[model samples]
Target chain A: MDGFIFSLIIGIFIGGVCGYLGTLMLSRKMALTAGPLGHLTLPGIALSLIYGFDVSLGAFPFVILGIFLIWLFETRTKLPMETLTAVVFASGVAIAFLFLPVEQAETALIGNITRVDIYGTIITSILCFLIFLIIRKNYHKMVLINISEDLAKASGINVRKNNLLYLFLIGILVSLGVRMVGGLLTAALFAIPAASSRNFSKNLFQYTNLSIFFGILSSLLGILIYKFTNLPAGPLIISVSSLIFLISVIFKR
Target chain B: MGKLKKQVLKMFAKDKKIILKVKNLTVKLDKEEIIKNLSFEVKEGQVLTILGPNGAGKTVLLKTLLGILPYNGKIEWKINVKIGYVPQRVPFVKQIPISVREFFLLKTTKEEAEKILDKIGFEKRILEKRLGDLSSGQFQRILVAWALVKNPNILLFDEPMTGIDVKGKETIYSLLLKLKKERNLTILLVTHDLNIVFKISDYVICLNKYCMCRGPPIKNVTPKTLQKLYGSKIKFYAHK
Candidate 1:
């Protein structure tokens, strides 16, 4: 009972952070970027296993590396973000499968969230919340450029500075989110609640706040459902968030 | 001779304040140059309207002037001068709900945004209305209000009246004249409305990948001049 309760608390913290990062991504319309960020953590996890380092530490640097590569890929080619996302995701999954030694690969692939200690959960929550604060406070400035870069620049908002800051924050958010929810399901936690609340909220701030509320509720309930029943935590959490999103859609003003 | 020289000097004296200047400006996309060595200077309190066809790089020039596009040029001025820009349209994506007042207040206070919105003839009720619900004309006015609230020294507008109704266009033109008179602002308006351009512009520049003709409006530079600048296929109607 104690273990399950502890896990639920960690899950809720992770969900809130993912919700915040997802809000930033949705507002920026960079949903495709979230995919590579989630998957690219796999190789890092595998490396950490082989070297006996904490998996997240290994995952952190590589995720930042992957972000720069994605930026470079975008600058070099005019390829659509969806295409890039698929390529990065496939590569990460393939590499993790090939390198992580057959015995451990299964747990690593599906994510061993049950094994995450309190320390890991605390670190993930802190990192995610910090990123949320950075993006949230500067959201007005970010939206200005997101709407129209030209208009923003003319109005004295620095476009390059904002872009770099946003990208860096995204790197940190994705790494922490993947650590908590597993790579494949992390994107869901990031997107679903935010996507659901979008119609109901009248402005950026409200949309983000509602998303966070939904995210925390879904995470707590999901863990509870999994603990009581034998159902998976990830899918349970996602289902709750998706249900909320559907409700928002049905009753959208 | 000394008296005559003094009089000539007085006649040639120009305003020391330079609102904006572009020298040897060149812009390219996919290796094709859009703005080729374009040069111009806008003085304080003057309106410079750029008139060109759809693909004549009119928007490109405006984007370059605002430093939006990557270009090769020497921009002599445009630092520390508060600038307001109104794009052709704001795309509705995400349905992010924001009232008209909150929208304008993205950069400033609600009180200041309301003051500008009032100047643009929007009522207080319009402040609480969702931006998505506003008509195209009303939305354009809101955009202008957003720019006006900045209290800008220079205003750059990209096809402000392109998709607006006739009444909206009239309101915008009159607003430009009023803004110039009231704020003493230097305005650079990009448009295809050559007739309207003549009506509100202090000077008109006919552009076709380059500056074809630039001078004060005159009846001498009639439809024939426009045809010569914008190709023989172009049509122009005289505005009373």
Candidate 2:
């Protein structure tokens, strides 16, 4: 496949899955969590830049560590997950700046989708499919837990275990998102489309479907624009999603 | 002949079977005790109502029984017992886009959900409405229906009538009584309505951070006990 085609395929897969997962996050009012977690991938992105490895691979470990810490603190303390994430990610960004190459900073801050090879595309597509399946299976349980922990517990849903798995999934998705939209805008890759979908959706089924549709549309549009304008795909993708969000707001029923 | 009769009566009492036993449960949050030195037992197919004023840890006690909160004590449920819970408030439901149908289908099959909704006297069309759009009464009924869909042996309701109006309250109480009778369910309900306590509950526990009184409602829930449980601020009137 051509370079742009490879990036387009990967972007489409990532966008679809992120949008699906983002519906759960948005419903739980953890939509903004994507932002800080996106930032938390900075250290890994910086390491990837230095070591000549895939950015998503480099971003994985740090985001996972950050997610684990946030989950642990949330269970132990009364503080919310978003607050804990902000604290952890800020430190991560600071550490990232110390080691990141100044010249290649743009690549870390805003991703280079064109750099993705055929092998990378194949691997990411499979990963996206797997993530989508796992999340789909646990989607209802997570929503029920969000509604009421006690009710979920009584329903025989293991709240703590499910929450940990959810956070881990978010960590994985955020890491992959870093390669598409860069560390700075990775949250938008998940959040904007979901938020846009929520405005007009009458039910969760509609909301999730619309979110996935918007996600793919934004990705395809962003990649096309990148091909023509030679602009960064990350910002373009977010810009397209934001445009959709604004339209959704205006046309909200 | 008298000794044989006494033994038979003892065997009958034993056959009732204690389904739940809580021994000296102490729940502390942030090193402050919420439920202290509390002990209670519930037999199968009995309705146990917990009555208390605000901040008396009634909700906390229910949560502890469900094993949601950490408690230092023994809470033993009979093996193979399934519990269904309806919480006091589901504040987040108002903002989500989940339909009533989706909420029910989360933990139950569509057929089971439809059956429960019908049993609760809700129209089939109501299932299409958004959970956030339902009136307080409808939402409460939905919560009840959600709990019943699982066919649990026991139900835990934490202040089921908190936001409901007077008429809705009547319906909820009557519905609870009806469901209890139909399903032979053991219920642990936390509520403040003293009037219905006598009407529905087989047993009542008046609590104020500790167990103030516990027994059959008519025999144990007196005006004096109400005073001790709620302090002199609450005036007790025996509803005929």
Candidate 3:
């Protein structure tokens, strides 16, 4: 019971944070970037496992580095973000295979929410809430930047600064999420809720709020189901979120 | 000789206060010089229209002047002056739903957004309309309203009326003219619409990669100036 409850709490926090960040990413059409970045955390996780360190914290630096590479290429090379993400994805997988023990790869890829301790859950939840508050406060600013960089600059909003800050925050959120969703399935937590909410949201506020709602719901429900059925929590949560997304598309309000 | 000198100074003087000055400005993207050694001055209450055809660096000049793009040389705005800008259009991606009100509220309050929309002749109901659902003309006006809410001393536009119909263009043009007179607002409008050059310009700067000619529309915008800027004979019948 205690383990189930812990898993549920962690799932909700990770899921909600992913969903909120997803809104910003999806606005920039960066869905592809999120998933690949999740995979890129593999070598970090491998190193953490080898060293007996905290895997999520260990994965943090690598994901942030991956984000920096994407941002660097975006500004300097002007290559499409998709192309940049692909380069990172290839390099990340290769690096992971080199360091990752084959026996542990399954657990690393699929994720095990049972591994998160109480301190880890508490810290992650607090971080998730903090990111939510910041994003909520800066919602309109984010939209303006997404709408047009030139217009935002004229408004005295530092478009580049805002973009980098958002990307940095994304690196943090994605890192925190990797432990629960595993690297492969974490992207769905970020993407599915936002995608579903976008179909019916009348304004930015609703779009964002509903995304968080669906994200929490998916995490909570998926965890409960995992407790009863012994299925992997990460894929089950993503499946639940995807089902909601499909239903939203079918109804299409 | 003193009288002649005074006459020449009077002929040259644009206004009492120079609102914006671009001196020997150059913008190079990659290897290509988009704008080269361009110089101009805008006064506090005059409309400065940058006239050029497609790929003539009109938009480049506006971006450079707005300090959105890096460029060589000096861009000086009078102290305490605020700037507003309207792009040709903001891409309204279908995936993310954003309302007109939410967009305006990015820079101002809901009440202020509604008021600005009304001032720009958009209906109050438009506040609830999704930005993606707006027609081209409506979208253009919404952008104008977006900039107007800031109450900038100077407004810069880059092809503000692109994709808007003729009537919509006339409406926006007149709205801008009204803004200039009523508020004494300085405007930098970039356009390829030679047809409306005579109609909207207080001053015209014809540019290719360089300033071909610049002065009051009634004087500097001549057939020779057009030929120099566009590299061809183009007839522009002055229309009221």
Give per-residue CA lDDT, model 2, range B4-92, as digits (tens): 55654564467557778788999999899998999988888899999998999999998888887898988877766788888999878
- Candidate 2: clashing pairs of residues: none
TM-score per prediction, in order, is 0.90, 0.93, 0.93
Predicted structure 1, TM vs. truth: 0.90
Best by lDDT: 2
Residue B64 of model 1 has an lDDT of 78
The residue-by-residue lDDT of candidate 1 on A52-76, one tens digit each, is 7666676778778778877788789
Runs with alpha carbons beyond 4 Å of true place in candidate 2: A72-77, A80-82, B1-13
Q: Give per-residue CA lDDT, model 3, range B1-240, as digits (tens).
A: 578556544544545478777789999998899989988888888888999878989888888877788889977677567888888757634556888887877888998898777777778888998888888887888888888886889898889878989888888888887888889988888988775567767899888898888888878887788888888998877564
Rank order (by DockQ, best first): 2, 3, 1
Candidate 1, residue B11: Cα displacement in angstroms equals 17
The per-prediction tally of clashing pairs is 1, 0, 0
DockQ-superior candidate, 2 or 3: 2
Stretches of candidate 1 off by over 4 Å are A50-52, A101-106, B1-14, B78-80, B92-95, B219-221
lDDT of 2 by residue, A198-218 (tens): 998989899889999999999
